[model samples]
Target: MAPTATRSPWPRVGAIVLLLTALLSVIMIAFAWPATRSSVHDIPIAVAGPSAATAQVAQQLSAKRPGTFDVTVVDGTAAAERLILDREVYGAIDVSSGHPQLIIASAASPAVAQALQQVAQALGGTDAGVPVRDLVPLPADDPRGAGLAAGALPLVLGGIAAAGVLTSLVVGVARRLAGALAFAVTGALALVAILQFWLGSVEGSYWLNSGAVALGIAATALTILGLESLLGAAGLGLGAASMMLLGNPLSGLSSAPEMLPSGWGTLGQFLPPGAAGSLLRSTAFFDGHAAAPHVWVLLGWAALGLVLAGLAAARTARRPAAAEPAAEAVPATVAV
Candidate 1:
């Protein structure tokens, strides 16, 4: 023992430093890339007027922004309004009167509304007013959508935190599942109360909003819980990392999915965070219109989590039974 050489700590220290550096780089990219690169891409908008005028306007939009807007040409402003109300489009350019008027749904996305207003101003000439109409206005209290934007990250964090606690402290798979679900339901209700009543961050049916929030929380917590059950502590890290790093940033809660660069936005919609945000908005502002897709995405994730958790639980149960049989056999052999 006295002659044994001591292991160098520098190697371990260097490895940790390198690992931290890599993690930092990844974190920076995940968050910064979305914010910096956020711009309109294939954002659906309607152009209402005669075919010739609408075509010309659409062509100008295409030429000016180039692939930014997906223009839906409608004969009348009424049709364009219908599209916005149905959640089919973000905003509309009503050129039906030969003068361009921008109809935007601020509740759908303040950022998109602002951007459309700017485009309208440019189209109508800066010297004249753009004649903007907010079809779906955000709550007066949270006019800028700051509350909803700020709330997105917390929802992800809350689910992760609940799952972590359950994994560490709760015993039995059934108990863990029960605890996560209880938290999701109760926590969502409480959070929604704050957002809707206190902060005015949301509108529409309170229970519906709570349900949407609960579903999102359940999806995240259950998925992480199942991962931990199967892969031990590493599973927790993987799940949390993916949710916080990938899901939260790409959620597009601050703006709109189409604002994110190309495919990333669509990818985010499949994740818990993005699905949750979209679902919440639909419930809050759009009367649950276009909510079926987000609901399905969440359901799929939650189902996957349940299947994984059940498999892990079955494996765990088998281990104890197998050990018991082996122990009994060993005792009998020794006695004989």
Candidate 2:
């Protein structure tokens, strides 16, 4: 008589899945965190104190950190306002008089906006004079500051695909490369079409749109594939956080780095998604101001990814002699 083997409850298995999901979630979020516990240096801010005051503020910012605040000295208050409207600087200060004015575009990074408000308050010291208030707010529907989101889309999509690929890699599983790549490319193109046609993301030739979208898709997929080959599952989380979160935030999504928080603000141009987005936008709206650099960046990512994938595959290649096991020599008489 054999006793029936006891079976474990399915609830424990569910708990383990849930636990893993939660752990991954935690790790991913941590990787994407952009904030320091207390403060960030080099935020692009507008200082409009008097010529002396403005210059002083600009100098103070530059002195604090390189690539933090660009500190443009506008012609006058109206010019500054226009800059804000055009999504130029985050906000402008008007230290034209005894008091100084603090301005901010709420549509930009809320953190930077809050930081500007704090700066305004600090300037309200007893020594500071009367202050005027002017608001160059973001569009009502632009809370996420998506006006600047176009440029970062490539990075975000790239990361998402990378993460998906990486998750599979973590399990020591590989999906159909062609199928996944095709899907990835299709999704990117669809997004580009939607943004360009529906959202009026660009005002250029259809060829340009197609080219830009295709370039983005190719670069993103290649980068993810390359990263997965190099870093395995971990690269997925890292690339996602790097391209999507940090790259977008640092790329002047809402306002240019000139108005970004000190330090990381100046870093906007060099970041991948940041650079790619700007280049695409320039080609879309403007006439493509020196797009070669950005094109190279995207190409570089794609190329690197491809190479890594090849290397990964090569590493798993069957050895030439290993496949042919040695055969025993048969006697000549046995041939008959």
Candidate 3:
């Protein structure tokens, strides 16, 4: 019998790459999305005074504003002031005096402080004597009143950068789909912990944070995987470009979504970064108020990716139409 021929190994490797790429891309996108940050509400503020007084005030504030601020109780006004200096509280209340004083410290989200001021003034006399000042002040280089521009932003962006680079490596040639997914999930969880618990960007429910992290990674990866499924490796570049350049700044990562151009603010939620960012905000700061919208958006993206990837595989199995070169003229007349 004639010797059996060994098959070329390239197509097998390509198939493996595509599978691994899909799973890995899903994970990477999840980590790239920033955690929740509301330009409007749920700012952390410390409260200090007699337990009775502070409790009443906190209850009153929540009752009036509902979801605007989360009041964290401190030992005393001194402690509240200290928390402000430590960047722990967006604003503070000292109910020690006959007319309680309000302290607004965080410059990053002055609207939060301003909102608190209105509430405090409505309850008490005036924040005119409440001593509103910037304690752990914003850097001169920053224009955003919030100091987050310098500190938390770098930390957040650093996490995204690392995730992207590592994802590129793992997804480029890996053949294990589960491993790729694990890599992305782990990266996003680590980043979520850093920002939410360790770094103090937010304080919220653990399940909410976990969900947010999962969505963040899923959104980024889905977009990337969709492109790769359509255009192979080149799609990775396009996805990265869309996420880092077009998505971040426009998504309002450094500020409130509404603060950007009107159209951008409205449409940012449609982008992966925007969807993830909104999802993060819902868990971290919004007290799950707007969670439904973002959940559906990210979930839709994830589902779309799965569907498209499946279709691409099926399409790839079909043979493309064969093209034949023009017939030779038999050297025109030489045959005769």
Instruction: List per-prediction Cα lDDT, in the order shown.
Output: 0.93, 0.59, 0.60
Badly placed stretches (over 4 Å) of model 3 are 1-180, 320-336
Highest-lDDT candidate: 1
lDDT of 3 by residue, 102-137 (tens): 787434344455666777778775446455555543
Q: What lDDT score is found at residue 276 in candidate 2?
A: 63
Writing each residue's lDDT as its tens digit, candidate 1 over 2-84 gives 78887769989899999999999999999999999998889899999999999989989988999889989999989999999
lDDT score, candidate 3, position 303: 72
Pitting candidate 1 against candidate 3, the one with the higher lDDT is 1
Highest TM-score scorer:
1
- Writing each residue's lDDT as its tens digit, candidate 2 over 1-336 gives 999999879999899999999978865653343333224455545665467778876765566454545577864677776666555566777776655777775644555666666666655665553354535343344344464465465545654665475456544324534534565556656666666566654455656655655565566556665667667767656666566656666666444454544556556556666556656555554445446776787777767767877777667564544555633344345665
Q: State each model's C-alpha RMSD to the native.
A: 2.4, 7.4, 14.7
TM-score of candidate 2 relative to the true fold: 0.54
Number of backbone collisions per candidate, in order?
0, 17, 15
TM, every model: 0.94, 0.54, 0.50
* Candidate ranking (TM-score, best to worst): 1, 2, 3
| Superposed model 1: Cα runs more than 4 Å off | 1-8, 321-336
